[model samples]
Target: MTVRYAANKDVQIAYEVLGDPATGVPLLLIMGLDYQMVWWPDEFCEQLVAAGFAVVRFDNRDTGLSTHFAKGDSYTGNDMVDDALAVLDAVGWSDANVFGGSLGAAIGQALALLHPERVRSLVSVMGTPVTAGTLRTLRYVRFGTVAKLARLPKAATREQEIDNLVTVYRTVASPGYPFPEDWARHVATLSHDRHPRDPGTTVRQNAASRRFTVPALSTLTRPTVVIAGADDPLVRPVAGRDTARQIPGATFVSYPGMGHNLPEELWPDIIERTRAVAR
Candidate 1:
């Protein structure tokens, strides 16, 4: 079921619940910036469901059907983390396992750090550690393109938008990795159709992350698993290795040939691992 709820920041978060609501342990699945819940892929969610997890997926503020804060409003990535927690509260779930990828993983780290009691376990996929050096190169590469895309006027044509997004996919997406172009185009269209892209917020969020380090990595007490793509160029394996080292009891899993994209092929194993962590 799709739902909307007001957050403390006054943003209306958009979310969808998957699996049998009454079955199994609840798991909150958060996607990256500007990503919708569907990005999690049906098979992945279903695999988790089959593994006895009720999954909740959502679009963050300024993305998908959620409330888009107007340009020029100063906010922090920390606020985005709070937004995740708010979504959990609004959904009426007191505690749940957390799974996130890329930017979503960073937010999940923030949530687990800030609200330890609310997260039972954490699965961070292709995510970076909270250090300036860890992400400096990535921010440099991604910031300019995202800033340009976000500045696009609301009147931009769908074809033009898709073209711009295709370029973005080429850059940010794992090189040599096969992208579901049609699926990505559809997602881009839906994002623009739902809300105007805000250049300022995207820029702000990127900058804010530099100052934000997850100090809780050292103190994270929950069962944790860090998944890194062997060929991921952006968030290199070094980052994931460092993150795992910092978490006292966390385990690290690096795939042999996987790229940053979470292909449907990996869902079964990922779901199995996630279920094991929950157990």
Candidate 2:
């Protein structure tokens, strides 16, 4: 429950560590676009800790308690990758196992490619490879969903903000998994109260993802696992498969009826798969 800051060049990245570092492999969890580290469920982190991992969850630059940027001064995706390395250095770990989703997943892939020595293992969940070409042609099968996300209404009031977030979760959530409306509302409320909503930061992050192209990944030697939701409307399952196909000896897993959101029911499987790869 203790929060700390790690210095990365000019920025101070905020992070929280769970479980004893002396106990197990260091596991770093990276969250997605515009989402803070708090988006990672406390229970999910606890389960990984109980499974013998020292978990480190952090706010990626413009999100959470980390450093905020001016309108046009945001860092690019490669800069964020170095930020991850700085987090490891701050914690006195030479290397660690990494798990990321969405944007986080893209960062994890870049980390494995650029700094292979710093990553012990990698797990990418509901993420796609971020190449310049992919960004140029980024279109989901559900074009209507993309349109709705693109035109999400701005909320001037707290209640309206929560409602907006609820709508978002509903729009992207897996049809087969129960949507936890109440929990989503709670998280939205906390996020709204904790930090100022910055649309520009999200825009810059998206641009960064598009600007930074991943190097050829067919030669990646790190143990990697790619997880995709069969019904994911955001990134799509094909992107996940494509990522795994690029990495040699990497494992790919798809959950039926799952979407962009990770449900509590699939956590056990995620933990087991992550542990297997870490071994």
TM-score of each: 0.85, 0.95
For 100-210, candidate 1 gives per-residue lDDT tens digits of: 887787887777887899999999887876543434436423345446655654546767765665555544565545667887777666655666455565665666555
In model 2, what lDDT does residue 143 have? 71
Error of 1 at 69 (Å): 2.2
Clashing pairs in 1: none
Pick the lDDT winner.
2
lDDT, model 2, position 168 = 78
What's the lDDT of the predicted structure labeled candidate 2?
Answer: 0.85
lDDT of 2 by residue, 135-245 (tens): 333753457787897788888887887787678778888777888887888887777776856888888898777656557888678999999999987767888888899
Which parts of model 1 are misplaced by more than 4 Å?
A: 131-156, 174-177, 211-214
